[model samples]
Target: MNAKMRNDAYSIFSEAIAAVDPAACIYRSVSKKDNELIISGEKYDLSRYDNIYAIAFGKAAISMSKAIEDVLGDSLSSGLAVTKYGFGNCLSKMQVFESNHPVPDDSSVKAGQMVHDFLEKTQASDLVIFLISGGGSALLTYPRKGITISDIARITDSLMRAGATIDELNTARKHLCSIKGGGLAKMAFPSESVSLILSDVVGDPLDVIASGPTVPDTSSFGDFNEIIERYEIGVTMGIGGLLEDGLEGVIEETPKAGDYIFEKTSHYLVGNNSLALQEAEIRASKLGYNTMVMSSSIVGEAREVAKVLAAITREERHGVSPLPLPACILAGGETTVTMKGNGSGGRCQEAALSFGIETSGLHNVLLLAAGTDGNDGTTDYAGAFADGETLERGKSIQLDAHAYLSDNNSYAYFKETGDLVKTGPTGTNVMDIYIILVDMF
Candidate 1:
């Protein structure tokens, strides 16, 4: 396997993900008009719906809400946009609630209450414009009847560090929450609902995007209980009460396929990781590199995937595989990283550091791994990049890539080496985007 081509490919791929910033994309997608909103090929005339209101939540909520405000500023009767802390900006007509991520905090609980309050006052003639995207799950969190915010936060963080899949984690979340799993949809019932989703989940399952607050639940309490037991997670009495209610048919079930709540509801998947990958492919091809989009929903442990991809690139470069030199390989998906240390990096950073150490300055090889959400793990940097020179750069500063990887501190390593990719809150999330560009034959 030729090591250099593999390294260069990965580096170029990272650049490609960084190229199409989501905030810029959202800004471009929206424009203002007097009585209409044109979003992702759907044209909604404000006059058609008797009453129009906005409800948006996610990592990209601030930017997405901004776009919504521009289009439906005067027409919107009331609206709420919730986002993580430190990402708020001014907006007209809509309340911007800055909250927390990866786990729901008190602000998240308040945001959930706000949603409930708003929906409680809604009428059948009202139109609810649900602007949902990745991170909405964490942003729209509300504990069930008896659960506490701290309990939710602890469970969420533990599940994340335990390397649970997003679906598994969300399944648990849906059961524990009052507004997730179709609970919001239940509240918005009998109203005209329109959900515009920027999917971060692989395959863009409607039920999995933001835990499908406005969608039906195919997984029931039994399924949720199974996952909890499998993970050995503690469930509070509040969650237990909800489960009992569900079992006894005391509370109404979430909207099913033929539910009346969906009578006037429609869902649009505006964007996804695959779209981002396709855009990257076209751009790389235009840049004179042959591109292959591996998978938009790539999932696995970050380091293992990085090493496997490295090996594949090496094989391709040595003329043992089909693709020739100067090729670009792309992958988009959320990778998991089990916390083995007090590392300060996310999956993308860990992947980058692992790739950097394994490649060890092999000429012509570079890699970039980053989350599409703009924040990777606990760091502000979206992700990190590494090439043939990355290891050498680490050595010059007496930095041990291996040690950093052990501690899961790729953010520190990449920051010291000046390879961290920074894009503040890309108002969209499809998943992580990875690009592997091979420039050296």
Candidate 2:
């Protein structure tokens, strides 16, 4: 491995994450000016509202809540924040709830109930501040009537294993949950609310971020059904019954663009993957590499994406690419993994391993792919690194990169080669970052 390039990769990744830090994102958009509250250039006259309450969910919940507390101070009534397990922190003005992620458990149900109950206490004159970020779809789950949390979990797991996109997964989740798909906005009806969102979804679609609890949902039951059919995911009996009810119009659809419930609701995107990628480009350029942001909406299967990136690395190395040697290529967005093997690995790790195999024996090229949330799938590591030497390092220990990749065991492969990038609980999520560096010796 090229030690300097490896270090620079981590530095660039860290800078990207810092750009989307939950608290900083909030502070940039929210502020107090005497009897008025300003958010994203819009002013809210504090005297007109009876109370100002806050509700936050997703991986950035606690940090975002704290920033709100600082901005509102004693004027802030009370607040609730629900985050993934181990992402919670003590706050002076708000209660924090910890729950499961990538899958919702019983605790998620409880948290959803808590949020619902909290909204019930609000009056028409009150102002609700919603702090939303990635992971809220799973962290703030409330199964619809007749559907169990286990059913939701099972479907979530199934769709994920089948490599469903975030949009597809959240579409299915929104239909099953009472608190998602503008359901929270519906529940807070009559109360004016503003959502400060840190978008982890590509293109910052308000309706898709954390399932868009405060925004109008463009997806419909028909869309959810299509996702299920496309993925061949089998629904539980209860879910199947609910789907039937939805299709038959026995149940209410999610709030739409013209719904009155959205009249007083406003949403502002405070941070996103593009913002992070911009910062990464700056950092990489400062580090003396000719940096270029390849894309900020990268998607598709992990290994397939890795193949394309590996090809770019080769092009850069041979002086045939758009960017010359000593070039850094950056791309930010989420990717999926179709889990055919039972082995453990996340999208980033899987991509890194595949890139390693394709670039084996090639010198002066390195890649790092990691989640900004400091986690990748169920592993402790955020992601991993791959360099020209990655495969050879594995061979020295009798490890075959191809075999591990076949088994979907990138975690083990990277762990053996000491290439895992671990940064525990980064307190933010704007999806994943990929850094490719090609240097001319």
Candidate 3:
């Protein structure tokens, strides 16, 4: 690939991925006409409900709420949106609450209580529009009856550090939270509710998004206890008492199927990582590169996946006979990194470093990895990118990509080399997008 071709390919792929960003594609999936909102081809009339309210939690909640305002206009009675600090914005009728993410804090605890209170206030004829998306798991934190906010926070931090997948992490959260695992829906029982979901989980499973505040949960408190024990997370005495009491059947289980709460609620998947991946593939094909979306459910440690993708790119570029050339391989999904060093970075940046070092000085190859949510880990940069020249740039600075990887400082390394891809916040959450373009020699 020549310089121009590579740059063109990068631009095409970047825009394609951004096209499905929460800020761009969410409105396409939902629209409002008067008192009615259409979501995913289904029409819902908000006028029928006497008390119309909204509860949005996630990185995309602010933008999603804004979109709702565009449709609902003055009819929005009351609502709440809890997001990370810098991501918060004003909405006419909805109160914006900003809190810590990846780790719960006092602010998250207070906001969660408000969520529970809001749910309790819903009447039978009320319309509860639940805006669900990624990052909500932490944003919507409300500990179970006996558990304290500190207990929940400690467990969450441990699970995250243990490299637990979202599924496993959420399973533990479901058991510890008062509003997760369908508990929020249970609170709004008999009140008509609709969940507008921006899926970040691979395959977009209903039960995993934001820990499924409105979806039915199959896991039990026992399962949650096991996870806590497995991770050896310390909990408060109150939490231990509550768990023991619950295990003894004192507390009623969370709402289940056949419950009135679930009957009155409807869940809709609005957008996901797969959509972003598909869009990227189409754009790559139009740019004259043969493209295939490898998978949207890509998982495992971030570094491992990057190494695997690097090997594949190397094979295809060298044309070991049957492998295709001049192709771009795309993937979307969330990946985790186990933090050991004091360094800072997210999964996408880690993947970039891993790929950068492995494919160093190999011409006709470029790799881009970014989180569609526009924030990777705790950094402002979404992710990073690398071409054949990445290693040379690092070498000039006397920085070893491998050492940075060991310290989980991918973002710092990439930023120094001017390879960090910053998108701020895209307003939509669909996890991460990985792009690899192989050029014919």
On TM-score, the leading prediction is 2
Single out the weakest 10-residue window by summed lDDT for candidate 1. 1-10
- Between candidates 1 and 2, the TM-score winner: 2
**What is the Cα-based lDDT of residue 25 in candidate 3?**
54
Predicted structure with the largest lDDT when compared to the true one: 2
Worst 10 residues of 2 by lDDT: 316-325
TM-scores of all predicted structures: 0.89, 0.99, 0.93
What would the per-residue lDDT of candidate 1 be over residues 243-332, giving only the tens digit for each residue?
678767786655567776667777877677777787778767766777788888788999888897787666656667677677778888
- Candidate 2 yields a Cα-based lDDT of 0.93
Error of 2 at 89 (Å): 0.7
lDDT of 3 by residue, 1-441 (tens): 245654755676466556665545557887777767788788887768787788899988998888877667778898999988888988899999998887888888899999888777778888888888889988878887667778878878888888888988998788778888898888888788888888889888888888888988877778778877887777779778877877888887666677766888898777787777777877877877788888999999999999988888888778862536778888888889988887998999999999988888788888888888778888998888887788788889998888888999998899889888886677777888888888777
Better of 1 and 3 by lDDT: 3
Q: Please give the RMSD to the true structure for each candidate, in Å.
A: 3.4, 0.8, 2.3
In candidate 2, how many Å is residue 265 off? 0.1
After TM-score superposition, what is the CA distance of residue 254 in candidate 3 from its true location, in Å? 2.6
Question: In candidate 2, what are the lDDT values of residues 398-427, reduced to their tens digit?
Answer: 999999998999999999899999999999
